[model samples]
Target chain A: MSHMQWQGYLRKDGRKGIRNYITVVYLVECAHHVAREITSRFKEHPVQLIGFAGCYPNAYADRVMNSLCTHPNVGAVLLISLGCESFDRKKLEENIRQSGRPVNSIVIQEAGGTRKAINDGVRWVDWCSGIIGNTMMVPMTVNDLVVGTVCGGSDATSGITANPAVGLAFNKLVANKGIAIFEETGEMIGLEEVMSSRAVNPQLAIELKKSVEKAARYYSAMGHGSFAPGNADGGLTTIEEKSMGAYCKSGDCQISGLIKPGDRPVQPGLYLMDVVPDGEPKFGFPNINDTVEIVEMISSGCHIILFTTGRGSVVGSAISPVIKICANPQTYRRMEEDMDINAGGILTGETTLRDTGEKIFEGILAVASGIPTCSEGLGHQEFMLSYKTFTPLGPGCLPV
Target chain B: MDKLIKIHSLDNVMIVTADIQAGEHLHIRRTEYYFDKPVGIGHKVAAQFIESGGKIIKYGVPIGSATEDIQMGGHVHLHNMKSDYIPTYTYEKQYPGDANPSLTNQSINQVL
Candidate 1:
């Protein structure tokens, strides 16, 4: 067994959380400033401000909220409601409580006013902090880790370098009995046959194929293949070519299961996150941008996110840490400050893919043990969510 | 060793990756190419001569049917190739976007 180098906050659910965060959540965009004030007042308490600003109720929003509220990292939740918004603060509070975490809800209108709400929120936070300070720490090992990988702003070098290198890291993690996940089903199009074959069960293989086919049909209907404008400039000719490269990130591990947004892995192994909505495209795209993907991974119980970028993305999640891996040597040269690992060294012929992957694996350990990523250190806690919907996974989807 | 060059195994034309001076002999995979002109990378050469409206193929996919007869080893992208399927767009035909939505609930103070 791998040695447990770091101790994490032990939860009643038997999960290890990397951080104990007190979140002041706003129910709608209207309450954001007040929620921010509540969190800002407690700057020394590791308090974070996060919430859904949508007045419209959405299934995707609910899914995201459910997963996030119960995320292992969060120890206490304080929901700030405008009192008249569509957001179901009751449900959000209930979910957090169900996770055995401390939760409080304050409706601003019902609480008298903004000043009273913030004061009440701060007092609640202070009391929660005293209680949270008593949670015990448990030893954690590699096998206990839930890691997610996402490749964004990709170019030709992405498939050949950072993506495949992350794949190697994923394989290593899975070999260590850790839970590994990869998303962006639309990018995995043309390689479904190759990908499906890696599923642990035949039923899962069929589900995998169906998901990719659905994504392809969806994109085709949009009159745009997952083809990006930058893709042509980077020398990728087709979606199939991109898919073949993107699929390498899974590192030949047996796909233990398939999950939709906010679903955690049932067993430790490799998993594919189907980011495309079920049925048709009613809820817009699966993710509005890459930050949404990172948020989903964190919600799925990931302690850390391994983000690979060819063109480069500086944004990180509001919760879990994002370790950005740079794929292109040129992009790294241009944006060194935004990158965490220079997988681009592979393109310069200075390092092998395995070497960079090992570097990333080491980086994961460091982040897990409290080392800050570029975004985390720079204080870039970007968050976003839009209206969307999904039908839950079928029995065939989880062949584990 | 015999030289061989197949632009696309399915298409008659071949792409020239290196310089080929006229009368200079070169070998590819197994077939030999007797160069007529020095061909550069991304350049195409005629595998055979044909009249207008002949079909052109690359990588085994029919890029487009030729509008006019062409010779082998000629360029096979855009100018000569046309998509067999005309593209169409409709709002009702929107594709599914990224669906992974995670709730970022940050609960800090109330630790029980």
Candidate 2:
């Protein structure tokens, strides 16, 4: 019952990715510059620089870093370590190797100095790049891909048009056995019940409801609500109203599980990513901005993010492809060059929601098949890492 | 003849979709209104008279509250409307008075 189709890179772990890339991950803030330098040394290489600047340890951060290091798109990893930090680099390398990908780590403190680290990193990356194309390519299909969606700077038109249109694509993806994920409980406050009713089971429905409620309570105590200021200018009055509009981006997929940041979906179905932290809010808000959400989704194994916006955002992630789905007709007309899909046509009477949804669906396949998005071509390689903590999901959270 | 402007079907209030000068005919969701004054974009006017402290409902939600009674088709905005939540102030009125009670030392101590 689905028209969506895809061709992706078959990875060693059996997961299919829309991109096949070699990632250079810096383990600490001190080594980031050198790591970036090494990646830049290979100008034409399909290499991306992603890292965390925090030296302090966080279980949540560790998990996210590990997931990204082993994501399916990655053929190899070159880790730059400061050696003194408690990042558990050895364990992370082991995890990546376990996924059957080529991985190497160079501790800056142990590898002589900055110049030496860069030299060693470049050598390792060169070696990995040599073997990247050697990996046998297997046939990949839409059922093997996993995708996520998030909307930022939403206006009134976003809810009525693009958000629901994304939901349509989400439903199509899920029906075809591809894993679909949606997040930002801060934006899902008022629609918790409506969202829960679409879950695959009663248990997941309960977890879905509890997660958004938790986010609402957390943001309420912070004084500034999760409702963004731009939302008000665009005709949204309150958090609940904004939430109702924001929730439409998920479409009508039956949520199969509730996941936390960096937690991979166990099977190919719809999942609600619980982005809010558990226990007392300690390490600031769960996500500082839009890029943080993109990073979280990528860290959870998404190959690309279907980012919908009404007010416009120009950010693109360092690791995965981002398809900017413009929602507002006026904003789209103004920023057409930056957008990947113009869902605003729905409002112009030029196209139906289904037509816009199909366009986004086809855009996803094209990007997966090696066609670059506007952000990817413009070199908008932005990265952000923030601190947060969470309790591991209990038995009730993930059910088979 | 005119097209009806509607805020929400469940709402008692409806906004003028277009500019309406005084004495102009207005129809909203089948209800007619003869405006007593002009109304601009994002401004609200009642199809009938509304009382003070009444809820300014839109989309079946409370947007804010009216501060004074006004006739049908009269302009509704900041002058005659106020938020239901605690009043917020800008830098101009930093001092405590009946105009701003939440900033008083009494309230501060109570909060502490």
Candidate 3:
């Protein structure tokens, strides 16, 4: 018998999810109010809302929406659309249906108005929630999990304690044949040489280098690196310094592949998530803030997020639980309620890195087995998606 | 005495493990050095003398170049260094190398 005791919401697509949430989606900004109103009625239930604010159709938006709607964690979907918006609601609804999830769409104009559309959406949700509540919980193990790690609000302590500790956790997770992902290529400006050297193959090493190079070009065009004032005040000096700190979240696993924002890992041991957009920097910053990266990970099928913060952040995500690992002992004390794991003990010489990593690995297992993370318990369901461009991954990006 | 931990064997700088005050001394590798200014936790202190425009090596790689010659035990940070790829920003004022990296940031090794 397996020592682990966890069950997942088994999806028809052969994927299992740790949570079963009924998602309310707004196809365009014009329909956001009705979607929010519908979700507000189900505040006591596992109902969450997400949407694209652009009225002009974007292929990227369509791809992300399809991925999110059919995500293993999503039990059902209710879409709100303005009658003349450019989003392809029919295709989205059909995609969800094909994924074996209940889905419905309410066009405000056809439904007579905002109040009517919201009422209609709420009714469908009320009915679908009952049906999805019966979703089978099947046996899941460490091998069945896809986990992503990201460092936000980082300070100097981040690279030393929490980030490396998270990396250790990744190492073990990959050893156990579980999928692990780490991202923010923009912060990896100066470390490409070292990172590429760790790739599993020469082609992947080259892809890793190209990804970071793309990020460098993108940030240069935007006129600002990911480095922030808080980072500076926290003792991080240059973008390269911040990148050095942020890069450790990947741990020391042999990188398996390079994946773009909406691409899931082909077969995961370790994968680098390149969140930067392709082409000229027309879409502004690759990701405006931290939550955007969280959403991207979720869209790519991450079961959970291990978020390490030295400066402290209190946000989570709509479809996944964010496990907050605080790196600074002082910051952990001030934000105790927000943080889940205190990896800061490494700095005080109270805990060893291996032990902290073991705790984080166990935390991932515990959270997966139905324990609410600090973010989940606090009802923090932050999500964001914006238009960006990308060419499909080259064959060299992911090799067996 | 505060502990300055070197993250890598080749690191020329060490990360301060605790909030430190000016004139506080640290003993590392048989050498004693005193802080020149109050430094917060996570700040870097030079492990050796680094000349202006030389690499600020950490984690065994150069994160950036020093803007001024830093003595052993001196604080190593923004005032004394900047990124070769792009200028780091703070709320106080925007650094000049961001929009035009060719101008301000071109002083060091151009890139990786």
Candidate 4:
């Protein structure tokens, strides 16, 4: 048995954070440039940039932004408004203040134009960073952790190595009373029956099956499949084949519940995030790219993300750190600097699945204890947000 | 060690663990076969003869259907295999990736 513990910043809402970051948010696309300038000034500090791109109001965007601003890892928040956007900045600032984090806002149109607003934002971020530096540190156990897994740029070696290895680590985390989430319903088309069979109850199983069906219907309506051409170039023939590889990241643990984006898990176990848009397909696609899914995971309170890649994706989240596990030996050789673990060793007969899984589990603890991931050190903070709609989950969806 | 891997016991297809050349010989599960076409590292090869329109099994489940008859050790890909659940969209038809004039434009209205 390995006895590993981490030191986390304790928040007022009884949650612990692995990374203490001051987040700078833009309410709409117009404020994005100002927010970027403010964040760029703090190059040496733990600051992140995130925002919504739409000027139109969306209930789902409001919920997700609120959840992100008050996320456990975020120590303070700065909202940049263009003086005329539909996102509710007042309510967002109020919620952050209620969570005991310093909150400030600057409207570029009202604050004497561009240069003046940038100066004011810089001063506020400096003050906020100073206050967050003094927060009390608490001993955090595995039970207090919520980890998420997502696969991008997948190929054949993903199923044989990295995905199953992640599943093993997920099983270990859940066995230790920790939360593990595996998302991307659009990528899980054909594995619904097999996945639902592992649900803790029949009601939960029904919800699981329906979610995948919803994704299939939505993508079919879009006139394109969830799979990208990169998947084909990497040798994945069909959606079912990709789903089979992606499903292995869920491990063999019995799924406890289902939740949509921004819905926190009430219990410690395995859960699936339904990334598909509910009702009619209003949005162009459920997830525009990998960063959108990463943002959704952070909004659900994940402290860390396990990202498996075979074709090599180099993206990190705005709040949570993404641990890259490369599944292809050739890709790993070409991009070793971007990967944290070489699961491709399994294909080379250099390591076993259990060993690679244990390595990932250890990597989680190291990152939770303040070790910067490759993406983080390399300055890969990719952020994206778009319009999405969801009717609240059903009662049977979350029994815990 | 085997150069190809059968992901499940019931799978009749094997994933090539490394790039294989034409006229290469492979022995799997006490049976031997010869490849007539080059196969990429991550592509699939038939473990047994698959008749046209038959299901291709992998991970103990059907991934797609064979569009044409495939002999043992034959390379399986988009040219001979296709999805059974939904139409697999390619970049050539969806985007301006290539100038393959044979491809037709697909409308979202038609799919809906």
TM-score of structure candidate 2 = 0.78
Report candidate 2's interface RMSD in Å. Answer: 7.8
Off by over 4 Å in 2: A1-7, A226-239, B1-112
What docking tier does model 3 reach? acceptable
Classify candidate 2 by CAPRI docking class. Answer: incorrect
Residue A16 deviation, candidate 1, in Å? 0.8
* lDDT tens digits by residue: candidate 1, A8-81: 88887899888788877888998898899888877666688888888888877888887887777888889999
Per-residue lDDT tens digits for candidate 4, residues B1-112, read 5778766557889888777888998877888978777778778889889999999987667888999999988888889998776423322344565555333333332346
Q: Number of clashes in every candidate structure? A: 41, 4, 1, 0
Candidate closer to the true structure by lDDT (higher is better), 3 or 4 = 4
Give me the overall lDDT of model 1: 0.73
TM-scores, each model vs. reference? 0.77, 0.78, 0.85, 0.83
lDDT of 1 by residue, B1-112 (tens): 1122332345555534334466666655444456665544324445666456664443333334555566544434444533332221122234477354322111111122
Q: Write the per-residue lDDT of candidate 4 for residues A176-224, one digit (tens) a residue.
A: 9999998978778867776889899999998998888777778777886
Model 1's C-alpha root-mean-square deviation from the true structure amounts to 10.9
Query: What is the DockQ ranking, best to worst?
Result: 3, 4, 2, 1
Error of 1 at B79 (Å): 14
Q: Individual DockQ of the candidates? A: 0.04, 0.07, 0.33, 0.27
Candidate 3 structure quality by residue, lDDT tens digits, A1-400: 3556588999998899999999999988999999999999998899999999998887877888889898888999998998899998888899899999988889999999998998899899999888988998899998888899888887667898898789889989999889998898877876777789989989889889888877766776677646568888878887677788878788776899998777877585899988888887777878888988998888788989999998999998899899999998889999999999999888887786678999999999999988999998899999888988888997778755
lDDT of 2 at B23: 76
For residue A245, give model 1's deviation from the true position in Å: 2.7
